[model samples]
Each structure stands twice: as structure tokens, then as C-alpha cells.
Target: MFKILVIDRCYFTRTGMESWLNQTDLFPASFLVAALHNLMLAKEHIVQWQPDLVIADLHGFKNEIHHIQQLASLFSVCGDGIKVLLLESGEDAQLSDYFTQFNIEETLLKTASLDTLAQSIDAIVLSRPTRTEPKPAVPLLTRQEEKVLTLWMEGRSNQSIATKLSINGKTVYTYKRNIRMKLGMDNRFTPFLSLPDAIN
Candidate 1:
């Protein structure tokens, strides 16, 4: 079953989106859901329930484009396989940076067709590629260091990893920095994802 979360401040607006999805039979597949008014209100639920998609409104935030990028990244940081579908007002239609930075699954105008929204949501949730192929070991990394590398590459935040590994967050950060250096990675983001692909 696919899990979905809706984050919208306006009660009627939230219900309307939910009703439209249900009326369209949007995701013929199963969907378990939860809806809340804001990110802060539902963040813990997100980590615990692990929703497959998050339908959110960017209009609620300040400097909305940048906020959207960070919001999308939060899913990754929390180790949730949550794809984001963002809604924007017409005044701030262009959000290319969000696409480049976090690569959100979809973005639509607040006034978009329900059919389009359904297709967008369905496409992302159903078309995900599974990590079935065996990945070769990184020759450059020690087994322990590789543990750190794997967790970071999977997008766990430092504090999350610290708790998981029972190490200090600073140690996780140092390990991350070292892993980047060993990988010849000059900047954050794309290189970490690319290096593993190349090795595989």
C-alpha cells in the first residue's frame, strides 16, 4: 500500500484536495493517509509512518522556492522514501532551483486539473527504481568508513546517523568530510550519488 500525507494550512483546501483524489480514484493502488496543516505538526508522524508521497503547498512558506527545496530534502534526511508534489501560486510559478537542488517528483499550479495531479502522483510513486543489483565494494573505504558513507549517501542527517551508530554527530560530520575527500568530491550533492553509480 502507498502511504500519503497532505500538508496544507487551509482546512477546506486540504479536504478539497483529498476529496478530489478520492473522487478521481487517483491512485488505483492502495493508499494509507494522514493530513496535517503544516510540516512542524506532522514531522514526527512522517518519520514514524514513512509516507510514500507528500502533497504540500509551498505558498505557506517564506521565500517559497528555497523553502520548497529544504522541505523536499527533509524526507531524504529522515530516511523516508517520500516523494514530494509541491503546489505553487501563479505569482511564483518558476521553481527550477527546487528541481535541481532536491529533484522533487512534481510541481503544479494550485489551479491544476485533478487528472494531471493524479497522473503526476501516480507516476512518481509507481515508477521508482528498486536497488536490486549488487553494488561492488568501494576499494577506497574501510568497512567502518563505508558504513558512514552508505548512511550519508542514503541521505541520513548527521544527528540521525549519530543516534544510529552511537557516535557523536561531530564524528559523523568528520567521517563524511573524509569520505568526500577520499572520493575526490569537491562539492556536496551530485558527486556522492554519482561515485557509487560509477563504482557499480
Candidate 2:
């Protein structure tokens, strides 16, 4: 499910956007939305919830330059995989820098049609490559990583593996992390298949 955060002081606009997106065919049952009024409060929510999309109205924040900059900084810091859609009363040249610097991709006038809003969202959300369940496949491990995994499975300590491999202990840990990522395993102890027969 995709999480959406709608930020606007105007209750009507905030909830209205939420309702329209919820009912629209673009998401239908896919969106989990949270609407808020304060930009400061929204910062806390953004850090905790990490919403996929944020639809915010800048009209209410036009007078608060610090708050606007703060909002932009918040996004710039932890905004990976997040899409922002800004709604403004008119084109504010001052905001162009914030938009470019922070990677805020979409900006629409407050009076824009819902269709236009939907199109912007469509381009942002639908164009992203959807993540699917990982399938079992032959893991492409480097020779060094395979050696580390072999020693790891034999219950060798990181220090022992490092000594045997003539590498630093931290390098052993790095190889293990890479191995787990390649296998899509969450923890060091998760059970996974052995190396393919071709490698044996």
C-alpha cells in the first residue's frame, strides 16, 4: 500500500484532496492517507510515517519563509523515494529554487482541475517501477563474497574469517551485508539456500 500525506491549513482542501484520491481509480484501495494542518507537525509525521506521496498547499505558508525553508530542508534530508506535489495560488519565483534543490517534482495551481492533479500524480506514482516479491534465483556472488559466506556458514567468527581471508574484520562484515542483500534476507540468521550446484 502507498501512504499519502496531505498538508494544508484549509480543512476543505486537505480533506477534499484526500477524498478525491481515495475514490479515484488511480489508487482505489491502494492509498493510506493522513491529513494535517501544521507544517511543523507534518515534519514529525513525515519522519515517522515516511509517506510515499505528499500533496501540500503552499498558499497557507506563503507568509512563513522560515517554515517553507524548513519544510524543504526536511524533504531534502530524508526524502528518498518520496514524491511531492505542491499547490500554490500562483507561480512564486522564490519557490523555484526550493523546488529544484529539494527535488519537489510537481507544482500545480490551487485552481487546477482535479484531472490535472490526477495527471500529475499519475506521472509521479505510476511511472515508478513497482516492487514485487523476490523470486528464488541463482545468487550472483563474487568469489570473495562466496568465500566469506562459506566461512560464515561454517560458524566462523568475523575475526577468524578476516584472518583467514587476510582482510579486515570490517571487510568481512561488509561482505556479509552484501550477501544478505543479494539474497533478500533481513537478518544474519535467516535460513537461505546453499550455493548452487554449479559452484559446488
Candidate 3:
């Protein structure tokens, strides 16, 4: 079962996102945090819930793009397997390049229809590479591992991952090390650099 955390500032928006996720029939469970104030609380929420991915609402906040990048970086460094799906308005479309630089995945327009939203989520969560030619087999990841890998790909820090996984920081490091070894990314620099591709 895949678990997701929905973060948004407005009550109505947060509820709407959660409803949409529940309606998708994909995720087994979801944790909702509306009007998130402190970054520490966001970290704590991840640790407590250990969600597979995060759907972050980037609207109506100061330094919205920067905050999203910070969260993305935190998830990447940590061993949490969380991917961020940004919810943006048309006005914010200009910030796409900024998000790309940070390796944040795709963005969802705030005004998008429910069907469009569902398709976007499905694309992100259930995509797989097609086998048209001979290529190295992608590692098959367990649901839990995928969650951790998603966050790792987002550039969360080790301590952040530890908190999200409710495990010791060292344990987070060990999981990452093991993941790298299993994926044949055991080299230090290689693991860090190829992590995004490995997880995705």
C-alpha cells in the first residue's frame, strides 16, 4: 500500500487535494497537514507517517519556490522515499525553470480538472520504462523502498530521512547504502549523482 502526505496552506485546498487522492483508488492511505507553519513540523510529520510521497501545495506562501526547493533538497539528502508534486497557479508557471534546476518533478496547475489531476498522479506514481531495446533492467523496488527512494531522489538529508522513517539517522544511512549496493550504485559519487535516475 502506498501512503501519501498532503501539505497545503488553505483548508479548502488541502481538503480538495485529499479528496482527489482518496478518489484515485491508488494510495492505501494519506496523511493530511493543512496550513503547515514550521518546517520542523513537516519533518516530524514525515517521520511519524513515513509516507511514500508528498503532494506539496506551493500556492499562497511567501518565497514559495524557495520553500519548495528546500523541501526537495531535504527529502533528497534524507533516506525518506518521498517525491514532491508541486501545485502551482498559472502565475507561477514562470518558476518552472527554477524547479527544474532543483530536480523537483512535474507541476500540477491549480486550476486543472480532477481528471487531469488524476492522470498526472498516475503518471508520476505508476510509470515504468518500456522494453523496446536491450537495456539494463531497472531494479524492482518494494513499495516501502520506493517511498524511501522517492524522497532520496528529491535530495532530502540523512537526518531528515531518519526522522521520516522513524529510524535512527544511522539506519537511514544504512538503508541508503544498501539501496545503492543493491542497485549497483555502490560508488560514493556515483550513488549521489545517479540517485535521481535510480529512484525514478
Taking the tens digit of each residue's C-alpha lDDT, what string does model 3 give over 1-200?
35556666566776766666665364433323222322434555555555455666655543533445655544553252556677765456545655565545567778878777666666665543222332221224444554566567567776776677777878767777766665555565444334432222
Candidate lDDT (C-alpha), each: 0.62, 0.69, 0.54
How well does candidate 3 match the true structure in TM-score terms? 0.48
On TM-score, the leading prediction is: 2
| lDDT-best of 1 and 3 | 1
Q: How many backbone clashes does candidate 2 have?
A: 0
lDDT of 2 by residue, 116-197 (tens): 8877877776756543432222225667886887677656778888888999999988998987776557754454223222
Model 2 lDDT-worst window of ten: 191-200
Clashes (candidate 1):
0
TM-score of each: 0.52, 0.58, 0.48
1 or 3, greater by TM-score: 1
Quick one: ranking by TM-score, best first? 2, 1, 3
Tens-digit lDDT track for model 1 on 7-75? 776677788776766653556665555666534334545665566777877566534223355565455
